[model samples]
Target: MTTTQGLGELTAAERFRSRPLTRLQRIQRLLHKHPEISPLVVLVIASFAFQLASDRFLTASNMSLILQQVSIIGALAVGQTLVILTAGIDLSVGALMIFVSMVMGSLAGNVGLPGALALLVGFAIGMLAGLINGVLVAVVRLPPFITTLGTLSVFTALALLMSHGTSIQGDDLGSVLTFTSVPVAIGPFQLTVGVILMIAMYLALGYCLNWTSWGRHVYAVGSDEDASRLAGVRTRRVLLSVYVAAGLLVALSAWVLIGRNNAATTSAAVDANLDSITAVVIGGTSLFGGRGRLTGTFIGALTVGVFRNGLSLARVDVLYQTLAIGILIIAAVALDQWIRRTGAQR
Candidate 1:
């Protein structure tokens, strides 16, 4: 009787140990290991679905348009991604971009400053704005949401004041300002300098995030600021640098924005603050921070562009397109929550 019991216990233990993961478990594991996979899969599926709905959806011309449309938001999202990876948010992204672009436009068009000089001034102002936000968040220890919310209002006012409620046309802004609008043809695809610049930013930031010590510290800070501090990471300096870096990118995007619109208006990209955040979240970057890829962010921005363009091609109503995007945002957040919970339990 004892021998039989021992054999049965051994069999039961072995079976339990050898149990295969269920499909859901496998999916969770995959997402945990590679958060971008979910968004990439979604992008592919959505593209195919849209293509089926409209034969024109997959055409080179239409595809190029989508890329063009996404470039501004994609660039903004790169900065947003860095801030988010540090477990912070910036509501002032759009406002800051507008303010910088307005400054650039005004200097170039009204003050007769050389376009190159105006751009350099814009960059300096952008870094200054970022520095302010960083100081508030890192030194003053203000909550990011509150800090940026306050700055958003401030930056918007500054842009309006600077522009005097007017726009600077590309003609007055000169070749340097409009350079990003110049188009390039690559095989079947038509692309802009702005698009190429956005891609380059992604590649550079992706490398920094994945392969550098600074990148690891960023993840660590986002994952647990207190723990990171305990581990000897200068959490405050990291936070400060992130905001400053974000500011530089914001300035870069402002240049792109000028080219894309063929003008710099305070009104341009008004919806970008939320749109950038939406792209970041949808790209599989955890809102809670410390987990995400730049590739996912690009995919997320492309996904939004695809959805809108595809839906328009399908003759879907604008309201429904907005609704679809809302649904995507909620779904992405929910998935992130689930992944976090499951990982904790394991």
Candidate 2:
């Protein structure tokens, strides 16, 4: 063949040798094209399946419960999402949350501080904890994982130490919890304030991630820390802010948790940081960083709720329920990795 014909023949052979993209491949390609839609699909599927599996799964009361359940992880996931967006993780979020809750309970319940003042102090303490993480990670040049892991131990120990490992009683709920528990009727459906807040927070963060400059900076940083810095994105400042945001959200999550339960346990939020990370990953956030959607995280929290609730309905042993969560965590992280690989290839 002539040189041009040879080249053309090589191209044709390569094309012929290549496996045609299958339905799944094509779907992945499409999903890679629009990251936001992927989570929506997951949410839809979970909602539909839950609706089918149990008549009570999607009922107004059950839905309210779902909101409360998702709100804890969902609120905390907001911060986790922000941190992950910057390609960082905060193992201290759960610990910090416990510490904050204990502080609040101690201040208002044991120390006789005004409810409002105690709440503010609790949030501030949480923010301060986040600030410490930001400084350690950004200014002190510590790796986020190590710094947060240390803080996780330190903070949780502090919580236990401060309260002498004692459980706090039924302290009054914070505004976040009270508001979330309030019922609202809209046509045929009723929702607590917490559900609305979750929806609002999700929508706001989703927009901020997609539309705002600061949010864009987070994605850019997560996408490429080096490139983001080279682009003058103020990497340290962004990281600092991300942790602070996460801390604040953790405080909010604590409020919701305490509100729904009307108490605080030294043990309950122990694995929250781990669980929050799980939700974020399950929602499709790339642990490797640079790609994820909040909606998926939203659904992820709900997916977790459904799984837990479903297990309850199925009468699984409590130990098995924990085992199932462990399994799901692994599966979610695996799926996230797979999605990341597929996205990278595309």
Candidate 3:
């Protein structure tokens, strides 16, 4: 009886040790290692759930609409992602975008300048705004949150002042308003140039962040500024570069906004700053900084679009949609905290 018991115990131990990981377990392990993967999984599950609720949810036209709807937010989120990757935030991004649009409208629509030249001027102005923010953070040593918060008010006021609390809308917008109307066919779907631009920008940014030395410096600074400085990273320069790049992205987003909305209004995209941050956080970038993926941000933006569209199709009230987004933001923050704790333990 003792011999039989020993053999049985040995067999149980072997079985326990040799048990192959289940698919769910494998996925959990993958998510644990790469937190960004979690958002993508959520996106898939959300899409599946929505599709089941409404047969039209998965249609090609709706898919195209989702891309179109997200194009502007995705563009803004690109800049926000860079800032967050550096452990910084830019509350002024939306304001800067709107300001640039107003400047573009004023120059092209009212001043009678060529639309192309006006676009260039808008870009330059946007970069200047970014440069100011960078100087405050990198040189003046101001906290990013404080700097951007102050600038947010300034930019918003400037946008209102520039447009005189009015919107610029007319035939005077010329090709500037119509440029983004160009469409390309993709299999069963059609998407505007703005959507294409958003995708292209993300691709370029992904390459830069994944393959460049500058990108490494960005991560280094975000991870630990003092340590990065000690390790020969030009922390100030990196911060400045990041801010400037974000500003430029904001400007590009402004141009797309003009195309999409066909007007530059002070009131447009009022919540863009918060929305961009939401996308970044939901995409799995820790607000504490130093960890995130560009692809994740893209997925996050799409995820937002999916939620709104899905919820709308289900006839959920708009107020409820907003509540859902708020819930998502809270859940994402919780997930970030959990990931950080687990990482610390590991």
Looking at model 2, the pairs that clash are 180-194
Poorest stretch of ten by lDDT in candidate 2: 1-10
* Alpha-carbon lDDT of model 3: 0.88
Best by lDDT: 1
Error of 3 at 245 (Å): 0.3
lDDT of 2: 0.75
TM-score, ranked from best to worst:
1, 3, 2
Off by over 4 Å in 1: 1-20
lDDT score, candidate 1, position 12: 66
lDDT of 1 at 232: 99
lDDT of candidate 1 over 1-346, digit per residue (tens): 1223444355665556557778997889889888898889989999999999999999999999999999999999999999999989999999999999999999999999999999999999999999999999999999999999999999999999878899999999999988999999988999999999899999988999999999999999999999999999999999999999999999999998999999999888999999999999999999898999999999999999999999999999999999999999999999999888766755
Misplaced by over 4 Å in model 2 are 1-22, 35-53, 171-190, 342-346
| Number of colliding residue pairs in model 3 | 0
Tell me how far the alpha carbon of residue 173 in candidate 1 is from the true structure, in angstroms, after superposition.
Answer: 0.2
lDDT of 3 by residue, 1-346 (tens): 1223444355665556556766855654566568678789889999999999898999999999999999889999999999999999999999999999999988988898998899999999989999999999999999999999999999999999888998887467778654775788989999998898899889988899989999999989999999999999999999999999999999999988888888878878888889999999999998888988998899999999999999999899999989988998899889777667645632
Q: CA lDDT of each candidate?
A: 0.93, 0.75, 0.88
Using lDDT as the measure, name the better of candidate 2 and candidate 3: 3
The residue-level lDDT of candidate 2 at 61 comes to: 71
TM-scores of all models?
A: 0.94, 0.85, 0.91
